[model samples]
Target: MKHRLVTATLSSITAAGVAVALAACAPTAPDSAGAASSGPSDATLTVGTTTDVVNYNPLIGNSRTDDWITDLMYPRLMTVSNTGAKEAQLATKWGYTSPTQGYYDIRSDMTWSDGTPLTAEDVAWTLNEVKKDKPAGTFYGQLGDFASAKATSKTHVEITLSEPNSSLIDEIGFWGVVVPEHVFSKAGSVATFANDGKDGGWVGAGPYTLSKVQVGQSYTLDRAKNYPLVKGGEPIAAKVVFRVFPDVNTEILALQSGEIDAIGDALPPSQVAKLKSSSGIKVEEAAGLGYSHMVYNLDNPDLAKLQVRQALSHAVDYDAIRSVVLQGQATNDHSSPIMPVLKSYFDSSLKEYSYDPKLAASLLEQAGYTKGANGKFPLNFKLIYSLQDAVTSQWATIVRDDAAKAGITITLSGTDRNTYLAATNAGKYDIYAGNFAIMDDPVTNFTLAYLPGGAINYTHVDDPTLNALIKKASNTTDEKQKISIMQQANKVVYDNVYDNIMYTQNLFFAHSTKWTGFVPMPSDLLSIVNPVSLASASPVKQ
Candidate 1:
C-alpha cells in the first residue's frame, strides 16, 4: 500500500440520546443458545494500533491505519464478506451489462453526514477522477481500463471499459472509496489534497465521522445518526477510538490492562499462544490473504542475474523460519506471489526452492563470483525491513547467517516503518523484506506487484515476456482462460525468482471478552474491527 501524511486536531462530537432511546435502538445479538438478545447501543470501542494514520484522503493514502480510519467515514461500492465473497455496501447490486460495460445501482436512502444525498454522481466522479489523475495509491490500478463512468440516473451508474476485465468489479467495487463530490471538487488537485479535515467539517457517508485527532496519540470517531448497513440503522458503539501504541508488546499490555478494547493489527505469531491462554481475552484466527516475501532489487547489478537471485532463494532455510521464527504457524509451500489461499489462481505445479547451501555456493561460483580470504563471496548486499515487524526482525538474522554459509555476505538494516516505506519506494535497498496484508485478486496483485512501474514492484523487474502474459490475462473475461494464462505467468515468476515468497500464516486477533459481535474477514488487515465489525459489535451486558 502507498503512504504519506498530514496532521490536525479537532474537538470531539458527542451523541445526544437518552438511555431509553439507546436501549430501544439496540441491535439484536445471538445468545449462547442462538436466540436473540439485546446488545449495547451506546458503548465506546477503543482499538490499539501500532502506527498513526498517514492521511485522511482515501484516494491518496493506502496504509493499514489509513484504511482503518478512512473506511469508517468513506463508503465503498461493495465489501468482502467473511467468505471473501462480494457483498453490498453502498451499491445494492452490481454486474456487467456487457463485455465492456458494468453498472451499479446504489441505494437512495443513504445520505452524507452533512445531510447531502449520496448518489451515483459521487461514485462516477470518484472513479473518473481516479482514472484522470492516476493518484499514487491503491485505487488507480484497480480501474484497469481507460474509460468513463456516467450516472444514468440518481441511483444508477454505468462504467465503460476499453477492454473486458472480469476482475474489475471485484477489484474496484471492494477497493475503491467514494468521497463527496461537492466537498472534494473544490480541491485544486485530488492527488495532492490532504483531506485532513482541518476545518472540522468533514462530511462522510458511512457509520461514523472523524471527530477528534491527537497526532501520535489517538483518533476519535463519533457515530453517525443513521447507517443502513447495520442493524437499527446505526452503529452499536456511540464512538470508536484508535489509540496509537509504540509497538506490539506495548499494545498487548494495554489490551490486557483494559486501556484498549481491541488491537486493530494482527498479533504476531510469537505472542498469539500466550494471549490465547490469557483470561478475559479472545483470540480469533482467519485464513491469510497475503504472504511474507523477499524482493531483490534488479537495479543491483548482482541481483540482476537470474542465477544469483535463484542462489539466494535456495540459500534461505524456509522450514526453519516457518518453524522457529513463525512458530510453525505459517505455510511455506507456495513459490509464487499468488498465495495458496487464492485456490483457483495459485499454481501448485511450480516447485519451491530447496534449502541447499552447497547448491547456492556452486551457483555463485558458476556466476564467476569467488570466495574471498574471509570465506565469503564478493557480494555484500544490504537487506532492509521494518523494525516494527517482530517476525521480520527475528528471521532477518537467520537469513543473514544462512546466506553466510553459502559464502554470500548480507548486511541487515532495520528501520522505523516510515523510513522503511520511503526507502522501498525510492529503491534504496538491495533486498526488501516485507508482507502484504491482502492480495485478494490475483490479476490485480500481479499488475501491481510484477508489472513494470507497478505500485509495489520493489524488484524493479521489467521483463517483456512477463508483461505480455499479464496483459493477456488481464484482457480476457473467461475464468478458465484467465486462470490458465495466470498460471503461465506464475511459472515465469517462479523460474526467474522475481520474488521469494516466505510463507502465509494464519492471522490471529485478540480482543476483550467483555465485547462481542465482531465479524471476522479474510485478510489480517480487515479480519477484525472492520467497519462492518465495529458497527455490529456491542458491549456484553454485565
Candidate 2:
C-alpha cells in the first residue's frame, strides 16, 4: 500500500516536482534485514576506516568509503571473482538481445530484507536514472555502457547502447552496485536518500542488510538469512560494523587497542614493517590494477611542448620513490597510461622514461628553457594534490623537488579530494597528482585520458592517431583484436609522454587474527568487502 501510493503519486513528477515529491518518501530507514541470530564471537566485526557515507546512493557520494558500506546491501549482477574470472552473482544468465542490445536474467529468489522482491526493474531503473543524471567527470563511469535500460518483465531487463558493449554488465553489475527501484523510483535527490537512521530506510538485496546507519560515525549491517549464494546459509559474520577515523594513525591505534578487528583502508608501505611485527595482526598484499601518476595541464606553454613533458618525466627518481614509499611491495610501471596488470593489453616492451636528471636538463635546454639568471626555467607550476591522499602529496613533493634539478620551478598545493578533483577536471591546475580508477577493461579505461579532448584528460592530449585508434578499438568484438589495437594506441600515447605514470600500484591490507577465511583479490580496487572477497571470509578457527 505504501509503495502503491508512492508509485502513482511521484514517479510522473517533473524534474522540478521531483525534489518536492520524493522528499517525503525520504523519511528513511536503514537497508536490509535478516532472521539470523546475531552471535557473540564471530557474530560482530567492527572495521576501522576513514571517510563517511554521505549519501546512500552509490552514484552520488563524495566519500570513498561509502561503497564499502552501500555495496553490502545493494548487491550486483556479478563481480570479478578472486581468481580474476567473471563470476555471476545477482543476474543468473545474460546475453545479447540484439546487435546493440543486451539482456539479463535476474535471480528470482532474491528480495530486499523487507521481503520486497528484488527485480530487474531495479537494474533497469538504475541504468536509466544514471543516464538521466548525466553526471560529468569521474561520475561518468557510473553510467557504464548503457545508453538506456528497460525491464521487459519483473525478472528480465534489456540494456541498449549505440554499440555492443562487453564491459558494463561486469563493471556496473558486479557486487550489485545499483540501488532498488522501489526505493529510488520516487527519490528526488538520490544523494540525500540515506539521510535517516530509521530501520529499513535503505533498501538493497546483497548478502548483508544495513541494520543501522549513523553517517560519519558508524554503520552496522546484519547478515541476510538464506542468501541464495551462501547455499541457504547466512553470511559467515552476522553483523559488520564500520567506524571512521580521521587518519591512518588513529586507525592503526584502534586495531592495536582491540577496539576494531580490521581496517578497510590500504595501509601505506611505510607502516608495514611495524604492523608485521605486531602479534595477532596479519598483513595481506595483492597485485594492483591501479596506478598513481602525474598529469600535465597541456594548456600551459611549457607542459604543452612534447620535449618539456618528456624532460619532466625524466626528472623524477621513480625507483627511489618506489623503494622509499612502497618498500619494494609494488611492480615497476611502463610508459603506457594502462597498468601492466591487464595481461593482454599491457605492452611491456614499451620503455618508460628513465630517471635522467642530466637528460632532463638537456631536453629543457634544447626546448629553449635554458636555466635563466636565477638558474630555473621560466615555467612556474602549481601542483594540485589531495590533502587526504598522503601518498599523492608525497609524490607531488618529490617531483617538485626533483624537477628543480632540471631547472624546473614548481609550487605545491594541497586541497581536499573534492577540491582537488574539481580543480583538475576544471583545468585549473598545471600538474595534478592522483590515482586513476581504471575500468575493468583497457579500451574503456584509456578513453578517460587518451581520447580526443577526453573527459578527464587535463593534458589536452588530442592526438589524431590515438583518437583514430580509440574509434577503431571500440568498433571491434574480437577480444584479441581489441587487445592488439588498444596496445598499439597505448604505445602511441606513451611515445608522446602524455602522462607520467610512476608505478603499478600494490595495495596492502592488515587484519586481526580474530577473523580469517579471507580470499585475497587480484587488486584492492575490488576491495575486501566485495562479494568475491567476502565469500572467503570466515572466522579464524581455533
Candidate 3:
C-alpha cells in the first residue's frame, strides 16, 4: 500500500442512525439447512471505515478507503499473496525479457464491466499515460526509469526501461491499477480527471463495479456477473458497502451491533483485547511490513547538525512508548526504516537508540547549545501529527514530556488527517510524525522516502552519499548484490539519524465470525477486505 494525500471530513453518526443504516445494508440472514434462503444474490457485506472515499480514479487516489473501493473495481496485473509474494491476477504470467525489458502475458478471459475486452492495448496505454501525466500518486514514482510500453500482441505487453531495475516488476505489477483505455482516453487531462462515475460511466474489470456513492455516508459496489477469480466465476456477496464513521470508536460499536460485518481499519491496540473477548467477532493478526517514524526537516539549521538530530533521537523513551502507548503490541527490536519482518534486508548490527536524558543533554552541549535561565535549551520546535491516529495522539504527549526532561522545549500540533497531510506536503512543519500502511519493497520504499525529489521525502535529505547508494541498488539485477547495497544504505540512514523509527506494530483486524473464507494479508490496508478475500468470503451458514 502507498501513502494517501487527503482524508475526507469526519461525519458524525448517532446511535439512532446506526440502526437505520444497518437495517438497510445488512446481509441476508441464514435459514434452516445451513444455507441462504434467497441464495447468494441476496447476500451483502457491509464494512465500516473511518475515512470517506474522496477520489474514484484509481490512478490518482491514494487513500486506504480509495484503494479499497477502486481495487475492487479496477483489476491489477499482479497481487501479493499472504507472504508478500507476487501472484498473477489479470496477467497469467510475467518475466523479464532482458536487463532493461519486461513483459506480461495478459489474461484474455477478463473483460470490462461494460463488455469491452481487456487486452494488451489497455495495459500498454494505461502504463504509458501514467508515465506521461506524472500523477501525484504511487504509480508515477515507480515509473521514474520507465521509457515506454508497447503491445507486442493481443495478449502480450512489453515494457522498456532506461536502466536495469529488478524491483520494477513487483512494484508496478502489484501497485499499478489498470483502467480501461476506451473510457479514459477521452478525458482532457488524466491528472485532473475525477472519474467520479457520476454519469454512470463507471467501467471496471474486477469482481465488483461502483454502483452508488452517498458522499459522507457510504460507497456501494455491485458484484460483476463474470469474475473468473472466484470459485463460481462471481463473488459470493452481491453487494459490498463501505459505511463511513467519525472515528474508530463508532466503527467498533457498529461491528459489535452487527451493523457491519467487518472494519476496514486496524483496531486500536488498547481495544484489541476487549474485542477479542466479545462473541461473534474474530480477530486476525499479521506481521507488519511498515513502521511508524518521525522525520526531522533537514532544512532547519538545528536539525541540520548531526549531534542535534542524534540528541533528539536519544531523548525520547522508546521502551516506554512501546510498552505503555503501544500496549506491547509492537516489536521491541532495533528501530530502522526497514522493518524486522524483512529479515534479509533489515540491518541487525546497527545499535538501537537508548533513552538517557543526561546523554541527550551532553550531546546538545557538545553541539554548542547552552541552556537558558529557565533550565532549558534555546531550541524550540513544533511536532505535527494526525489527530485521527489514536497511537500517535497518545504517544505525542509522552514524546513532549520526555524531550522536556532533556531541557528541550517542544510544542505539539495535532490536526485533522486532511490538514496534517496538506501541511506536510507544503513543508509547513518543523518535525513530522506519521506512519505508512505498507512498505513491502525496501528499494522502492527508500527511493520514495529518502531519494532527492521523491514523493514522500518529508525530511528534505539531500546527502549525495545516500542518494548514490540507493541509485546503485536500484540499477542492479542480482538479488544478493542488491541486498548488500540496501544494507549499506540502511547503515547510512541509521548513522545520519535521518528519521526516528518508533516501532513496527503487529496489525490486528476484527471481523464478524458469521463470515468465513477471509484471506489475511500482511498490511492493515489489505488485511481482510482485499479483492481476493472479499470475493471468497461468504456468510457462514448455521
Per-prediction backbone clash count: 0, 13, 0
Give the winner by TM-score: 2 or 3.
3
On TM-score, the candidate that comes out on top is: 1
- lDDT for 263 in candidate 2 is 74
User: Model 1, which residues run further than 4 Å from truth?
Assistant: 1-40, 81-84
Weakest 10 consecutive residues of candidate 3 by summed lDDT: 19-28
lDDT of 2 by residue, 1-542 (tens): 00111111111224442321110110010112111222223567778876666556666544566667766777767555332334556666655534455667777777887778888887888777766765443445534446888899988887777664554444455423567776676667554454343634666677677777676689888777646654224566768888878776788889988888887777778888899899988787655766788888778887889898888899998888888777777667776676666666778788778988889889988988767899887888888888766567666778888999888888998986667766876789888788763345666666666775455676777888888887777656566777788988888878788887888667777778777654445554455555434533556556
Residue-level lDDT of model 3, residues 1-542, one tens digit each, is 11111111112223242210100111111232122322355678999987777678888875678889999989888766434556667766665656677777877788899999999999999999999988887788888888999999989888898997767766787788899999889887677779988666599988889898898899899988877765556778889999988878889999999999998888889999999999999887877777888899998999999998888898899989888888899985476887677777878787678888999999999999999989899998889998777788889998899999999977999987767877888898878998887787888989988998888888999889999999998887667788899998888888898878999878888889888767667787677788867876788777
Stretches off by above 4 angstroms in model 2 are 1-42, 81-85, 136-139, 142-145, 189-200, 211-216, 437-439, 452-460, 531-542
Per-candidate TM equals 0.92, 0.84, 0.90
- Per lDDT, the best of the predicted structures is 1
What lDDT would each prediction earn against the true structure? Answer: 0.81, 0.67, 0.80
Show where candidate 3 strays beyond 4 Å: 1-39
Clashes of 2: 13
List clashing residue pairs in candidate 3.
Answer: none
Higher-ranked by lDDT: 2 or 3? 3
Give the higher-TM-score candidate: 1 or 3.
1
